[model samples]
Target: MTDATLAQLDALPTDELRDRAFALARQRRDIKFFWDLFTHVTHSDDNTQDGWIGSLDASIDDAVALWREVTGHHYGDAEPLVRAAFIDYIMQHGK
Candidate 1:
């Protein structure tokens, strides 16, 4: 990622970061793909549903910009996988 991208991501709140990640993942894959992945990962598990929406509000733009840099592609091509991975990780790890 570029310095500017890293700076942007570093400035974002955790929740926003997560959101951007999820959005990117969704872009990479289809809704069904991400949904299935999420369901499979969270099955039989207690996943936290709070705080995520607000964690990265401050840095959403930067996070998204940084995400593009990290993936070397625009959101349309990379978001789904990024989002899915973020969701999967958070669902399994509570963060």
Candidate 2:
């Protein structure tokens, strides 16, 4: 991608950044991207306390939260690194 394209992508709103990266992942059947997203979300904070890893329901909830985040329906704003992850993924794969 050109520098201008990169600039444009960087210039997008955080929600739009998430949307574009997510749409690209779905369109390409990129399971790795989704996995990466899941990992990023789950690991964003110290959510591993109190047997967080042992519950399938918790995992599902996290997945749903991730979906909401990507769809711009999340209750809270994403973290800086999570937002950077979206931009970095698009920079690497959207080119």
What lDDT would candidate 1 get against the real structure? 0.44
Candidate 2 per-residue lDDT over residues 46-66, each given as its tens digit: 643345344454443364455
Error of 1 at 41 (Å): 11
lDDT of 1 by residue, 1-95 (tens): 22324445545555565665556544554344334433443333354233332344435344445334433443343345444555444443332
Candidate 1: regions farther than 4 A off = 1-4, 30-95
Which candidate leads in TM-score? 2
Measured against the true structure, the TM-scores of the candidates, in listed sequence, are: 0.30, 0.58
- Evaluated at residue 55, the lDDT of candidate 2 is 48
Range of the 10 consecutive residues with the lowest summed lDDT in candidate 1: 47-56
Best by lDDT: 2
